[model samples]
Target: MSTPLLSLRGLLKRFGETVALDRLDLDVPSGEFLALLGGSGSGKSTLLRMVAGFEAPDAGQVLFDGRDLAGVPPHARPLNMMFQSYALFPHLTVSGNVAYGLRREGVPRAERDRRVAGALAMVGLEGFDRRLPHRLSGGQRQRVALARALVKRPRLLLLDEPLGALDAGLRERTGFELRALQRETGAAFIMVTHDQGEALALADRVAVLEQGRLVQLGPPRAVYERPATRFVASFLGGANVLEGQPDGAGGLDCPTLGGTLRPAGPLPPATTACALRPERIALRPGASGTNTAAGIIEEVAFRGDDSLLLVRMPGGAVLRVGHAEEDGAPPPRGSTVQLAWEAAAVVPLLG
Candidate 1:
């Protein structure tokens, strides 16, 4: 394999008693769209800033294109960052903002104009380059910020919650546009986001970070289907975590449910968590199903296309279920209901 486009070696940072990054290491292949995924305060943003030269690492070395980043200023590095808050200049027009970086670099007028036009076009804002920041919509302003970053043609693009400000409908549209734009440019994009769905949809690989470390890194499907840790499983998507013991039968012995459930993964005797995705648990009770629990309906929220039912299982386990074919079948609050899940649907977490 060739050398990675960017590499971090023993990256360490600190603030008072807090260790922002603890001997962290990461590598980004050329043209790879990798997402640094985690909840708030997971240190993903700190690592990204260190790579962008905004924060100095206390111990580790940062390398871009095999060159050491020691003493290389942010302006000198082949990198650009787009913050969650577009940070557009209210006084500058779209074209003026996009041309700011090129102007500082002393690029000739003709070349700057050509690059600016191309960048704006790439982000679908070609004809609107003359609009002020206030005149443009939330999505358009974000595109302008992206155009400004692309005008410099940096090798690495660091996006921190790039679509955070947009509404839900606009966010979905921008996600597709951004993915296509990245593919067209082939820039190694490393996005730091708390939205697990965004990362799964956009990134070729996702690094799930915890307190201050990478808990798991893999393809979206792999990470979702087989999370290395219990935290990863529950964080990426909602899961019903059941505390149970392994029975001699290839299933879990749930004393609360008084039944055995299909094993999600090979579980140890000391396993404390059983991860079963909401979708995997069926609403219609199965006769031969290995696991079944009696619960009372606690809450029923009817979303547009589906219904979200919160069932309070025996022993106080609140299991969330999504039903697709509910025709106003309201299980009255406190009414008893049977919850059944396939024996093979449960994955055990023993760590």
Candidate 2:
């Protein structure tokens, strides 16, 4: 196989007593959209900064297209980083802002003009060259920042919470726009975000970090459907983690639910817990099938397309369930309902 466009080998960073990155390893192929996802102090931003040359690791290597990045400054590196704030200069026009990097590099006037124009057009800002940053909307400002970064034609692009500044509706629309822009440019896009929805929607693959360690990395659906650990299962959302011991009868001896549950497939010998997504559960009037349980609805929340229900299991465990509203309304709070799920929907998780 060909070498990855970018590679991180045993990367480590520390700040006195705190470890920012703990020997993390990653690779990015050409034109791939990868998101670094984690909560605060999980090293997502730190890792991105190290790659962009804003920070250096104490150990290991950062390789860009098979070349070492040590001793390279941010401007000298073959990449551009767009900050969370969009980092646009209020005094500069859109064209001027896009051309700033080129001017710093001493590019000739005519060549800079051509590249700036092309970059603006690429980001759907063709006719807004003369507009200043203050005059542009949030989305427009984001586009200007992107155009500025892309005008240099970098081999890699780094985005730090690119859509965090936009409202919900605009963020959703811009997420697709950013994905499309990355595809069009064919540059490997590495983005750092704390928003789970943004990572799931925008990234081709997601790297989930936790407390300075790499927790899980895979395709969005794979990571969500088959979480590697309890942290991942809970952190990525929509999962009901149940702690139990093997019943030695092709199922789990879950004390919390006061029963046994057979997982979809054979589990690892050491497996002690499992995750079941709320949407995978089917609610009905009676519990007569395998993996069935009786629970009282503790809370009901309507979420437009679905209703999120918190159910109190017979053994006192609160299991969250997301039931689709297409068929009918969810049972009212305090109603006893039977929850059933297929074994296949259960994912065995590590401690």
Candidate 3:
């Protein structure tokens, strides 16, 4: 395989008694969009800072195209970062802000102007150059920040919560624009975000971190459907993890469901648990078959596009089931219902 565009090997960082990053390693191929996903204090931001040359790693290496960046300063590194705040100069116009980096590097006036215009056009901010930061909408400011980063033409771009400042509606729209821009540029991107939907939708591969450890790294579907650990399953998709023991007859003796469930796929050795996504479950009033269970509807939550039904099984374990709005109104609360799913929907998970 060709060498990756960026690599982090045995990277470690600490803040007094707290371990910010614990010997984490990752790689990003050329032109690939990788999302560093985790909650606060999961070391995602610290890792991004390390790559940007703001925070030096306590141990290991940050390699870019086979070059070690140990002593490189942030500006000297062959990369640019877009901050969550957009960080545009309030006093400067959009054109000025986008050209700031090029001017600092002493690029010729003509070349800088051409590059700035091209970058702005790439981000769909063609005629907004003279507008100051405060005059533009939130999304426009985000694009201006992106234009500034792209103007540098860095081999790798680091985005620190690029859409965090936008409202939910604007965030969704800007997310689509961000993905399109990345594809058009073909530049490697490493984005730090805690939003699971954003990570799954935008990233080619997601690197999940927990308490400074790299827990999972793979394509979004792989990580969501075949999570390597219970934490990953719960974190990525909020899957219902059911603890069980293997029955002698190729089935899982799950106490949570009050029965044995035979998985369509062979269980890995020592597998003692499984994950089932709420959306994979089919709920009805009188469904009965293999992998079927009777339950009482404890609650129903309508979420516009879909509804969530909480069902209490015979064993008193409440399982969430997703009901699409197109399926018509869901059974009312306190109604007796049946929850059924395919054997293949039961994903074996490791603890």
Q: Model 1 over residues 172-228: C-alpha lDDT tens digits?
A: 899988889889888999999878888999999999888778788888888887676
- Candidate 2 residue 113 C-alpha distance from true site, Å: 0.8
Candidate 3: C-alpha lDDT: 0.90
RMSD of 3: 1.4
On TM-score, the leading prediction is 2
The global C-alpha lDDT for each of the candidates, from Candidate 1 onward, is 0.83, 0.91, 0.90
Regions of candidate 1 where Cα sits further than 4 Å from its true position: 256-258, 268-270, 286-289, 326-330
Could you tell me which 10 consecutive residues in candidate 2 have the lowest summed lDDT?
Answer: 281-290
For residue 236, what is the lDDT in candidate 2? 92
What order do you get sorting by lDDT, best first? 2, 3, 1
Which residue pairs clash in candidate 3? Answer: none
Tens-place lDDT per residue, model 3, 185-217, is 899999999789999999999999998999999
Q: Where is the poorest 10-residue window by lDDT in model 1?
A: 281-290
lDDT of 2 by residue, 1-351 (tens): 999999999999999999999999999999999999888999999999999998999999999989999999998999999999988888999999999999999999999999999998988999999999999999999999999999999889999999999999999998998999999989989999888988998899999999889999999999998899998998898588898888787788788876677887787787898898889888977667579998899999998999999999977788999989886989899999999888988889876
TM-scores for candidates 1 onward, in order: 0.93, 0.98, 0.96
Order of quality (TM-score): 2, 3, 1
Clash counts for the predictions, in order: 4, 1, 0
